[model samples]
Target: MDIRQLSYFVAVYEQGSVSAAARLCCVAQPSLSAALRQLEQELGVTLFARLPKGVTPTEDGEKLYGHAGRLLSQLQSLKASFSQPVARVKFRLGLIRALGVERMSQLLREFSNNVQGLELHLVEPDEHCDARIITPQLLKAGEAFQPFWHDSYLLAMPPGTPLSLQAEVHLADFEQLPLIKRTPCDAWNTLYPELVRRGIKADVRADIQTIEYALGLVSAGVGCALVPNFDTLLQRQDIVLRPIVQLKLERQLGLAYRKNQTSASLTVLRQLCQPVP
Candidate 1:
């Protein structure tokens, strides 16, 4: 019904338990529970299903989560508009979808530790942010780009599969295998056509939008996909990752910000992201 109640609801939905959400909000458990009950009563819908271990969102809760996230974000921006002038620096950072949520969280934790008096906001690609962690493909004119790192693509196969035994898989190996396709790989866009022109075949059995989805299909024995050697994906025990020595492909990752604008937080981030000599 109110901002506080909605905050409590969002925390509960995200954290999955009243106790956990209470710890996150720095509020009492009973008070947080009372707020959820009040919200449910007002909405006349059960938002979450109470379970022995924790809670799971109901269908209605899932629907409410999207709206609540936007509402809270806007509210924070509105408050920041007035308070930000005199308060500690509030910085917004945009991350591309290729960097999964877990990776983003890890980066945020590191940034929080390194910077003082910084209130960091994680944003999507479309939103206006102080700076963004993005691929070179998304860079625009007048935006200053700083190369951060490179992520190489690797062949991802289901565990114990015949191809998993190979120390290094060649591009020719893909000719005989059913490949799972993940969209928006700049490297693949160029490589696929060139492969076809050179008499190599990529038998794409499935097309997926995200690396996670492609990895899931690979784990299910659906087919193999070319996935980025991201930390979380590389650590997955369900799939086997092998280097593609025949065709080396990688995309450069970077931080981009407007050239003329200067901010304390942005300066700090630039200093931190400076490449080692």
Candidate 2:
């Protein structure tokens, strides 16, 4: 119900006894037990099983333990930041899963370091964030969108594969090869429809969820995969990336943020992420 109650709940859950938790928290045992009882009453859930010697968390208590721990950690961080002379600005950033977090880690870390009093929080694509790095499909109506990067889809194959040596690969060239499928991809969703429109059949070998898994399959020479022209993916010497000659598909990435939102950090992020003309 409150910070104190949550703290007490966590203590008893960890210590497994009211007396032990009270000693650890420097509080009276009766007060600690009363706090836990009050918390359970407020939440309308039996949080623990009373034992003769100690206590054990019930199902609901186990679930709340994780949440309470994280909340306490965030509260501690908030208090510590407030104690400092410089005010800390919490900045949320939303990233599309397909854009690849590993590729952006270094650049983001550099940005975080360069900007003083800035605390970056990574969140889901649709959540509230100061700025969002998202694809065109995810771009909302009123948010300010700035083109950040232009990425093309490339055919990735093992280095020694027959198609790897081709200067250009076509739909017809794919008939004999087994294609590794990546689901929930904007590129695939767009490409497949066009392929169907053109009456080209894709000989799908497997349907995978993540790019890493798809790349793993390609690396093991299980089958060829279609992936973005990311530097991280392209830099692999074990795989060959060839331009799709017949289908010149590419995605335009942009930063989307509310028009009313403006800050020093956002300005610096815009400068860093905006494409150079």
Candidate 3:
């Protein structure tokens, strides 16, 4: 089976409809169907089970799908590598709000200047939930992609807050004060239950969306809000970031791309962000 056939198959599996996959793949339905058939014939196994609503991968198809995804990622990476020289490496980066936009851009600029032939394409996570919500989609699309950094979460408070200088603060201490929080929809949702377990109910004084807004609330003394330590924007003189001594609130940041397609430039980028051993 050709790469085109595998591409069509994977698209069908992901989209759940041949017609939808056809639209996404920019190929006619008939051609996509024909390719699927050709692929099944070559493998001598039934890859999908036709149903009234859509196609589902058969057991054998499921097994092949995993391998097919990795193979395609490698092929795509190879194509990208061949098209660009070492001095012109193209990189796609996804950043969550934990890493402020200004800091991310600055880091990318420095990274590009340091690495020869490096181009950076940066995408911010949507609604701060992209790391958990969208990362699986990226992984399924290509297993070769991996994240490079893991940023720990920290609590942000107005400069004079009593807890500002402490290395960490427990949920109980936060409950004693007013809180400004990202809505339950934010990625920090994963940490909410732990707060509840500590017998602390978030006394949310304001519900904010973006990190800038949350920091703004903290600066205004609206309440303390949890933020990632990597956010340089919140590290201003007016604001104080203190590690959560008891609650290790944290998330990871990293590079992801087709695994086999990892380039020398990408390696350098990864090395720069590598955590201390």
Candidate 3 per-residue lDDT over residues 1-277, each given as its tens digit: 7889988988887666789789867899999999999998988999887776677678898898899989998997888777755555666655544455544543565587677666666665432211221233334454344455555777778887778767677667856578876853333675678777787777778876778788888888888887766533332566887766655556554554454554576666666655434
- In terms of lDDT, the poorest run of 10 residues in model 2 is 101-110
What is the full ranking by lDDT, best candidate first?
A: 2, 1, 3
TM-score of 3: 0.52
- When sorted by TM-score, best at the front, the candidate numbers are 2, 1, 3
lDDT per model vs. reference = 0.80, 0.81, 0.67
If scored against the real structure, what TM-score would every candidate get?
A: 0.63, 0.65, 0.52
Q: Against the true structure, candidate 3 has what lDDT? A: 0.67
Per-residue lDDT of candidate 2, residues 82-188 (tens digit): 78567788899998767764437545855776787777899988888888998777878778889878888988888888887788788777764778989867778
- By TM-score, who's the top model here? 2
How big is the positional error of residue 2 in model 3, measured in Å on the Cα after superposition? 58
Q: How close is each model in CA RMSD to the real structure?
A: 8.5, 15.7, 18.1
Worst 10 residues of 3 by lDDT: 127-136
lDDT comparing candidate 1 with the true structure: 0.80
Error of 3 at 61 (Å): 61
